[model samples]
Target: MTIVNLDHMSTNQLLPEVQKAMIEAVKKNYGNPSSQNAGGEETLGMIEKARASVAGLINCENKKEVVFTSGGTESINHGIKGVAFANTDRGKHIVTTNIEHNAVSKSIKRLSQLGYTVTSVSVNDKGMVDPADIAKAITDETILVSVMHSNNEIGTIQPIEEIAKITQEKKIILHSDAVDSVGVVPIDVQKLGVDLLSFASSTYYGPTGVGGLYVRRGVRIWPIMDGGIQEHNKRAGTENIFGIIGMGVAADLAGKNMDKRINHLKNISNFLVKELPNYIDEYHLNGDPAKGLPNLVSFAIKYIEGESIVLMLEDDGYRASTRSACATGSLRASHVLMSIGLDHADAQGTLVVTSGMENTKDDIIGFLRALKNIVKTLRDISPLYRKNQ
Candidate 1:
């Protein structure tokens, strides 16, 4: 009855090397990065090195463009608000996708409440935002277009480069919430033609509560947090010295092994897709299987509650998820699933399983075996399932 956990969407398993780096950073903590003292200089040096490492991960030419924040949510807030505030004179209209994370959606809602215009472009059944749709959404008043690089719930990889081209041609700023895509997938801001990109350290094996944003040089953005000048005056607050250092180490590891990890996850995912049908009946795979992150798989088991299935799996020792970690407490259906054309009933039955380095082929097979039994048990008590049978 032992269960295998398959809900590692937030981050990959941390390697021993990463753990060692974090310990070293904790022991080397010197005071204020802005202090004029020698220790301050050392802290500042560490912070700068971390900045360079982050910049290198995204192929950013200038390390000064990267600004550290608490995590992806904070980075998203700063990117959206900072750009919006700085470009108010140009236009108040902003563009984004309907499937964006709450970080982007809530921020846009707040902006709309504040008297700014916002446009949420719709996605197709595959949860993809068409770049042409983004171009059409643009107007003379459009100043920024923010699209996530990948959907968190369904693992749909958006057409960011095409959207970037359109935005660049129109002189509009393009930003991507790459929190879900950065560590698991390869990213290059220059190659992607993104004006701004946001990512978190935890998404790739670094510690939580630390993230960063890449602002293309010459892009004007106001500081969201007001305090002592730090992060080249782009963001102002006392830096999380240890977190930043840990992020540096994690980024280096991610960049070095991204390709191998991606391939490994792909193998694991393919096995799941091939074997899942043997255990469960009448299920739907969410999103485009061909164009998704290697480690993520979202599916809907008809006539069963996602939460019930998650709990059932947990009881057996598995740790799968019902939806985005942010939406677990809510009763409402997932916005991402709804955006991709799933009805409320189908959305409620959705489960998102994302793999990490710690997961293995045997782990997936074990999960499938447990999952099949759980679904069968749940469907036995469901009136709808009985009627369908």
Candidate 2:
């Protein structure tokens, strides 16, 4: 059976270009980036080239501003904690939204534990953050404002540029987790006015476990880990040579095919948004449909458990996910969904559909068919569904 994979937000298949690039690096470039030998020189060149690729993809003014990290989580951790610690002399407060990924929200929460005040601003029902609300949240003690460029769960895009203007006017550091937006949409640090930006390679079909943090030139950030001088003393360790090369190739591919991919993702997501509602009894779109990521289509279906629908669809050769955060065999409703004012029950029933390079129109049709059948079967025996009638 042909399997339809729409869980792109979790992870994406490595693109062929990325795979080939990594393979070449593994077979030929085995030297450490810090070495001064010939092999190391070659590897260093490759790393720099990949850095340029990443910098070009984001339209960053300085390639040196890009520091490679282990992945999105590390980038976010460093971005949030780094800026907060570095700028504490200015203030001990950081501001962000409640709908951010676990990386951003949790990191900020950790800071709040360290006696730094972190104010998590709420989003509107559409999962969109109002710039006015952000402006109101800022105060004299606000040292850094970390916001996500796009949400991982609901795929809602935020106005980082507008938020940046406010932070800039206040001379506060602004960090944006652009992990979900890097390859899908255009990103320019200058245009966004973000002091620090975090991104992941997997989001762009690169190898997993390799990402980067863009620190605007002259922005002070304290290194989270200390050891060697790798990553310019920001992150210390032996770099993942193969992963970096894969990310570079992936960045090149994403830059070249961005428009085409965007159009494809939009078509796939648009079809689902328009057609999937027709199959479900009661559902509500969870994000700003008018202005959001084209690769995502999320909705909360009433009464039926989303996990059940996902399992049934999986049995039918379709793979998807829900907003429910599964941990240690227990399913917790997504903070993202709840932040948008969804009740616990509704949040548990939220289905998250994401499109990527591997998807096509045919895949979308197959997924819809399987989804319709699964939702019907699950609702037929659902105790909540029966009682709600």
Candidate 3:
């Protein structure tokens, strides 16, 4: 049995080029980037080269705007908490959407515990947040508006550009958790007009445990980590040199191949959407397909639990996810699904399929075929399906 990874959202396969770069980095045994020596200077040069590549990937003019961190979670935490703490004099109110990842949701939740206030805007049935709704949520006390570039679970792309305009006019700092969208889609920080954007390397075939935060030149964000003045004084800690090198390579490749990758992913995504109805009944698609990420498809299958299907599919050599990997082990139905008006049963029945550059249309068909069998077996034993039937 050949195992195919359909859970690209959880993590992506490291590209060979990135792996090679990382291996070379480890072999060199480089010194600290901050030290004033030949070894340090050489290491610093490499870091800057990688930074330039990553900066080019996002179209950031100044490479100094990008700060390396542990991963997407750290980038998010740094961006949200840093901004909240630094701008306390201006205001303590923040705005966000209801369906954010745990990083954003919990970061703001922690702020709320610290006496800061938050207004979480709601999304429509298709999981897209309205820019007007975000505009209405801002107030004189609202210091920041944090929205995600695209949702990981449902793949609904938000209108960050429109929201940026609103925040700019109001002078509120706009931070977007772009972990799922940055490298997967065509992202231009200038075009998006966001003050801060958080992203992960694994989203684009880079090494895990590596990511970066893009802080617009003049953004007022404090350092989350207090120590050495690393990451342009935005983040502290010894850099993950090996992982950063891999991420830089991955970012460069992603920028060059984004168009080809998107077209391939769209072909697979379209195949999945077109073929799913033929194989199963009593199901609905989540997210706005026309406006969503081209690489992901979320399906809410009725009367069957998603985990059972995921496990059975894994046994049959296909790998997928029920929800965000970050939210794993939680028994509650997904807050994202609930935010989009899905009932508990439907929320528990969702299967998220995120494709990568390697996945093909045939892979989608094969997965759907296996899914048909699994859904049938599960539904046959489901009391809810029997009652409905």
Candidate 4:
């Protein structure tokens, strides 16, 4: 088979304008954004501007509410633990969904060990958490409700706006892990009604190893880490100057081109759904197709392991994944798929293909063809498939 390499989707392909911004950052490597020197003052100004840029992208009321972190995981930790610890006196109970990224899940677990009561609300077969369920689960002792805006594996977008409203009426804090939705989808912090939102730089074509948390003005959250008085004393660490600059550039680019990018992703997704199944049989789409990320498509093929199919697709030059990149190390089936009512075996066979600007119609067609051949070969060798046949 003549394979086209589609694996390793690069954000550079999505944001060519950021390259010059990154280069400029390298040339202006001044240390200690808080230093007394003029160079330091300039760096500090740049950092503040980046913060405002990020805050503006999310419709945050003020730049002071934005705190930069290393990435999504750190941002989630800050939101979960920071809120839980800061409001311990108010309550020891926290609510979140079962399908959250491990960053939020693990943070909840860590807080549980530290004597906090964590309540994990279940999602419907569409992988959406019912706002009523969240409202029902909330107790007077419930201090926070952490839900993801979208599922990374299956692309199921939760009702964060409704959830936020429910939390607010109850006078509880609502935090959303908006990493997947930040760039690919439109978000207004006020519209979403979330008190604290987490977003990653890489998801929006920014450089990796940098992310930010949006703490709505007047929301109290404790610092998860202690060190230099950076990020408005909310997060402590030397600023990632280059990465932050790249993030700002990326956010600006995304904001300007968001509508066009969304349309492109939607077109590619429609093409895949309409075409892929014609070539590949016995495949089931996962999650709510109507209410998911525009750029993400997840499906499960019977008699084929998801990871095996991903590897085969990679060999054919298609960059895809079996589940959330964070959950790649785990051998277990994806919790997201399971939450959506897929059986364990079906969930284990799930493959997620997320589109970026770099992906073309030819790319999707090539991936579909390769996937068809791979599934045929795998099914031919499988005893279960043979029996079914």
Q: Which stretches in model 4 have alpha-carbon errors above 4 Å? A: 1-14
What TM-score quantifies how close candidate 2 is to the native fold?
A: 0.97
Q: List the residue pairs that clash in candidate 1.
A: none
The regions of model 1 sitting more than 4 angstroms off are 1-3
Q: Report how far residue 313 has shifted in candidate 2, in Å.
A: 1.0
Q: Each model's RMSD to truth, in Å?
A: 1.2, 1.5, 0.8, 1.8
Residue 13, candidate 3: Cα error in Å is: 1.3
For residues 322-367, write the lDDT of model 3, one tens digit per residue: 9999998899999999999999999999999998888877788888
lDDT of 1 at 259: 92
Please provide TM-scores, in order, for all candidate models, with all chains considered together. 0.98, 0.97, 0.99, 0.96
What tens-digit string does per-residue lDDT give for candidate 2 at 1-389? 76778888878999877887788777784788799898888888899999999999998998889999999899999999998888888889888998888888889889989999978899999888999888999999998898899987788999898998998898888999999899988888888899999999998899888999999988889999999999778899988889988998999999999999998898888888878866666888988765899898889988888888888888899888885232214567888889999999888888889888778888878888877888788888889989988
Rank candidates by lDDT, best first: 3, 1, 2, 4
Report the error of model 3 at residue 179, Å: 0.2
lDDT of each: 0.89, 0.86, 0.93, 0.84
Order the numbered candidates by TM-score, best leading.
3, 1, 2, 4
User: What C-alpha root-mean-square deviation, in Å, does candidate 1 show against the real structure?
Assistant: 1.2
Q: Please give the range of 10 consecutive residues that has the lowest summed lDDT in model 2.
A: 323-332
Candidate 4 lDDT at 86 equals 88
